[model samples]
Target: MDAIFIQILNGLDKGGAYALIALGLTLVFGTLGVVNFAHGALFMLGAFCAVTTQKLLTISKHVQDTSITFFDAYKDQPYLEIWWGDFGRTIIDWSVPLSILLTIPAMLLIGLSMERGLIRHFYKRSHAEQILMTFGLAIVLQEIIRSIFGANPIPTPAPDIIAGSAPIGALFGLDEALVYPWWRLIYLLFSIITVSGVFAFLQLTTFGMVVRAGMHDRETVGLLGINVERRFTVVFGLAAVVTGLAGAMYAPILSPDYHMGMDFLVLSFIVVVVGGMGSLRGAVAAGFLLGLLQSFASMNEVKTIIPGIDQIIIYLVAVVIILVRPRGLMGRKGVMED
Candidate 1:
């Protein structure tokens, strides 16, 4: 029972990331009608945002160790620590969370630039063209990142306070063995809040209403003097911000690397397909569903029965779901029909 519960937590942790990324992808598609293959690059950039923040905070000067007479060695003394003492160290410790501020503006600008400078040109183009162009853009972004950060994975850790595991089993009155990382739990909560905020913004705001209306009939909305295109540009930026946050938050869980975005991109696309082409709710649901399934498939017992099931479970489920429901789990009737 403890093992099962632990896996459930694991599933939710993975699901939160999948759902967040898929939600952003779905948003861009639904709003802009453009297949944004570069969305994952935005995520990768976000992780780097955290990395950059940490680096900037810990900019250090090397001090020679006089005690090492046999060999010359230098130790890094961070500027923050040297200047502000414990306070600066605290700021450095909190780099991951603090990076959110940088990630937001950085991602927003990048998204807007991508939309206004490039994506706007492809609005009426075929999906194949959009895919090709965006995929090319993604590669370009990846190369740029690789050139700057190199090919190695950079570790970005959580704050010291929540870096350890939580006694979840004790809290829930379950077996003492059922502990989970605090960062993962925080990430799950963050995902829930972010998803809800997006939904509420769309469902409650006038802008969101118009955006939804535009998604349904863009021409009619444009005919109404609504400037749906501009709104869509903003929507693209919002999607980027959302995806960036996901990547930034996930950096501690997985090391950040130039290729990490591409890794998640394929699975996220699969998630979007399983959820439905432009269905927000479907994307979220399918993300969590696949995450849960993948988690269970990774169990030793399950792997014993079906070797390497964990690696293939998500794809297998996607195929089965595609075969069963051509439109997807919650796809609208007319989507991709033409």
Candidate 2:
């Protein structure tokens, strides 16, 4: 029972990230009528932001023990360390958390630029073309990131206070049975809050209403005298920010690497599909549901029957759901077509 709960928790976190990424994808697809293959790359960019900030924090102008022959050979001074001073110390200490703020505007700009410069060209093209071009864009983005950040996984440490495991067993009246990591718990709460906030914004705001209106009928919205293009652009940017934020928060748990975006991309696509494409509520439901399902798949007994169940659970669920309901749990037909 205890083991089962642990797996469920694990799945939820993974699923949460998947769901968030997928939600963004679905929003753009349903609203803008473009298949955004670069969504994953945007997510990758977000992780890179965290990694970049982390790197910036630790880099220094002060040379490390130059007594080492390696430093002598490289002749590299830790110039940034000296250049940054206490500012660097503060950054090193708080960059991971602070990165969320920095990545938002950056991601938004990238999202808008990509939409206007790259994706906008394909808006009038067939779905197949959109997929191909966007997929190509994703590849390009990955290559660019790899070229810049290298192909290594950069370690992203959680803030000091949230670094270790916390005892939750006592709260459950079972000592020594239910410990959880503070970071994991914080992430879970963060996911819930973000998901809720997004849903609320869509449900409550007139601007969100305009975006939703544009999604359903871009022509109609345009005819209604609203600038559909501007709204869609913002929506595209919003989608990027949503996925980027998820990626940023996720960096600590999963080491941020150039390929991490590609790694999570498939699962997120599956989650979006399962959640019914454009349904906001469905996306939230499916994200948590899939996360829980993934968690359970990793349990000892479950894995005993099928080793590495976690690896296949998501694809399996996607297959099963698609076969059962081609449109998804709450999908609306033609939402992806403008």
Cα RMSD (Å) per model? 1.7, 3.3
Error of 2 at 22 (Å): 1.0
Local accuracy of candidate 2 as per-residue lDDT tens digits, 102-126? 8899899999998889887888899
What is residue 104's positional error in candidate 2, in angstroms?
0.6
Cα lDDT, model 2, residue 52: 82
Q: Which residues of candidate 1, in runs, are more than 4 Å off? A: 64-74
Error of 1 at 244 (Å): 0.4
lDDT of each: 0.92, 0.80
lDDT for each residue of candidate 1 in 1-338, tens digit (9 for 90 to 100): 88888888899889999999999999999889999899889899989999998888899989886778999888998988888999999999999999999999999999999999999999899999999999999999999999998999999999999999999999999988778999999999999999999999999999999999998889999999999999999999999999999999999999999989898999999999999988999999999998899999999999999999999999998888778776778889878743
Per-model TM-score on C-alpha atoms:
0.96, 0.90
**Residue runs of model 2 more than 4 Å from their true location after superposition:** 63-90, 333-338
How many residue pairs in model 2 have overlapping backbones? 12
